[model samples]
Target: MFDQDKDTGGLQGKVILITGGTSGLGAQCVLRLALNNASHIYFTGRNTKKGSAIIKETHDAGCTTPLTFVECDLTKLASVKAAADKILSEQHRLDLLMANAGVMNQPPGLTADGYEVQFGTNFLSHALLIQKFLPLMDKTAELPGSDVRIVQLTSTGFRGAPSGGIRFDDLKTVQNFRVLGGMMRYGQSKLAAVLYAQELARRHPNIISVSVTPGIVSTELVSKQNAFHRSTIWLSAKITQGRIYSPKEAPASQLWCAVGPRNEIKQGAFYEPVGILSKITTKYTQDEDLAWRLWDWTQSELKQWLD
Candidate 1:
């Protein structure tokens, strides 16, 4: 699995940004792209030691392109912008983006930006990142090999959200707050991820925007949460025989979604299980107008961070 492909230069010459690079699924993306001969690899995370260590390890393992680390807490819009600006200052080209970092505990906290933990980190941050970084989306509208992409990482667990749809009246879910409140709230946040992807796909027409599930990955991210999340996962993993994927395996879908063949995959497609194009939730597929509104609302909410 670690060997380089001689025939398909799948990610060659691409400048890619992945959000949660310190551990888990995102780190796996860092490894896969490094070996695939990508021209530049930049990822964002809050851990200075681990982030720098991953960069060193990538170099030791032999990467042809420059490997970089940008520290940004996905929970904060200001931080995301700082990271994007850092990328712009450092390089002129950006070929792919994996909006993959998030926190999942059922506990409710607010980001520095003052949104709920679930919504702020997972939803608004990714939305803001894309809007601010739109300039680097590569201006090709019709040309083949013009690879520009935004891949959103959502979850099957999103289906478990009580809302089962975008809860427009309670985007933050602060009034009905409980542990279950967080369950639905987290799911609601991921809906924003998927809906955001859908919105970008429709509006841009050319950029390859899609959402994907990483299949359950066994990573340190799971352990970072409070007792509530860890207990639920522990119970779930036991019932499923604890087969959550290793971070390395989890990146299979995300990496493919970013660089996989466009003709084979659909635009605005959701993917999982090693490049298999997955389905959008039925409600989302039908609610094109809702996605558009959600996109606009997010822009309005983050207007100050847009610059």
Candidate 2:
């Protein structure tokens, strides 16, 4: 199931931008991209020390490639926009934009914008990112046989997430604040992630936009979660029929989405577990209304930055 040309060899000379590349799944993505000999890999994170260290690690891993680290606090919309603008100043083409930076199940926390931390970091931050990079994504195919990619990392808990539907009205969930509520809300955010990708691809036909479940790999994503959540990670590692992958395993599905050769897969399709891209689960795939509504609401929220 591995092709050198489609994934390994072809990755050379591609320019990829990944958010939250300093840790967890994002760190894995950095290593994979470096190994693939990508011409340039630009990633951002808030942890300055860790960010620098990861970049050094990429070079030390024998990438011998250019790695740029932008200090970005995704909690701040202004920061996200400014980072995108910076990239746009120097680069016109962004071959792969993996929205892999997301807060897993977290306790109640607030961002600089005063929005719920999970939704802001996981969904809205990414939404604003796509808006800013929308132009770059559309121009991917202009580079002659170049197919740019946008991969969103969602979760298996998407459908069952949230108390009742993805509440567009109460994204912050000020009315209720239970641990499970937040966890479900986090899933709701992931659900919105694919739905947002769906809406984006529908609007922009030039880019190959997709969402994938990274198959529950062990990473710092658990540390952001509760004890039970952390235990769930351990339990999955122990007893699951499928192999519980490490943080490194997190990026293969991502790199596949970015660089894998697939003959078919309609733009905006949601994929789960590796190169297996399918639009399963009617609860999510069938909800066009929810998707558009989410897009509209998110745009409205980020109107100032968009302006």
Candidate 3:
């Protein structure tokens, strides 16, 4: 377990951003960072009511740190760009970014950009957010005592991706395979997240980029699932004898990655809960060529939004 008392103070004076900050693991992250005295906290969520609630909750808890909520709908690329632009215009330096918002095994659909819903919401939009903020993060790294990091939340489900990993030819359509279609799409997006972190560390050595799996957390992501899906999850947990963590307990790994000592973290590595470096057994996740390919494709696709 993460020692909140010991680790929470590490973020003092740091500027931070978190996606999907309205609830679940993301909301926990926001509260923890705010209470720890981060210089400023800028978070994004689609619901204005929930956004305001987070801000109010921080204030009610006597957290003096400035918390700003930018309304963002991750399913839309235009909204993602606008959120980035709004933050970039306000803050000169951003020390940490937590790409914590995502969707799970939902029905087949497309995002506003015409890409598969899961892949677009989970990976592509976060990619655009990272791209927009890279220059600022790079500059932040140059400052004295600066430590810049990007934390991408991935999952063990990445191992369940289709045979060839990402199906690039069919990204524009819903990858509705007959069986396990939703999981397959979810896995592909998460795989992209892991690969993106690796390529990011390689390209920007100054900034620390890493992916982490929070394990099975008892959040709306699971609780709101249909009865069948929820039962399947519980059965799997029982078989594995795994622990289902609450939202408060689940943010430990990502929080540690965000504020832990720089020397202790490996660049471009994937981690399990509370700072354990996990080995990538799947050959697809270990492919350097595929990582580069995804990076190039993402860049080409988001070129219009970058400027």
Which predicted model would earn the best TM-score? 3
> Which 10 successive residues of model 1 have the least lDDT summed?
1-10
Task: List, residue by residue over 139-195, the lDDT tens digit for candidate 2.
Answer: 766888787878888876686566555776666543255557667767777888878
lDDT pick, better of 1 and 3: 3
Candidate 1, residue 159: lDDT: 68
Candidate 3 lDDT by residue in tens digits, 182-269: 9899999999999999999999999999999988787888998889888887776666437577788889889889988789999999
The whole-model lDDT of each prediction reads 0.75, 0.78, 0.92
Candidate 1 structure quality by residue, lDDT tens digits, 259-302:
76777667776766667666536565457787788877888888
Clashing pairs in 2: none
Residue pairs clashing in model 1 are none
Order of all candidates by lDDT, from best down to worst?
3, 2, 1
Candidate 1 residue spans exceeding 4 A from truth: 1-8, 140-144, 172-176, 224-242, 279-285
TM-score between candidate 2 and the true structure: 0.91
User: RMSD in angstroms, all models?
Assistant: 3.0, 2.4, 1.2
Backbone clashes in candidate 1 total: 0
For every model shown, what is its TM-score relative to the native structure? 0.88, 0.91, 0.97
Model 1, C-alpha of 299: deviation from truth (Å): 1.0
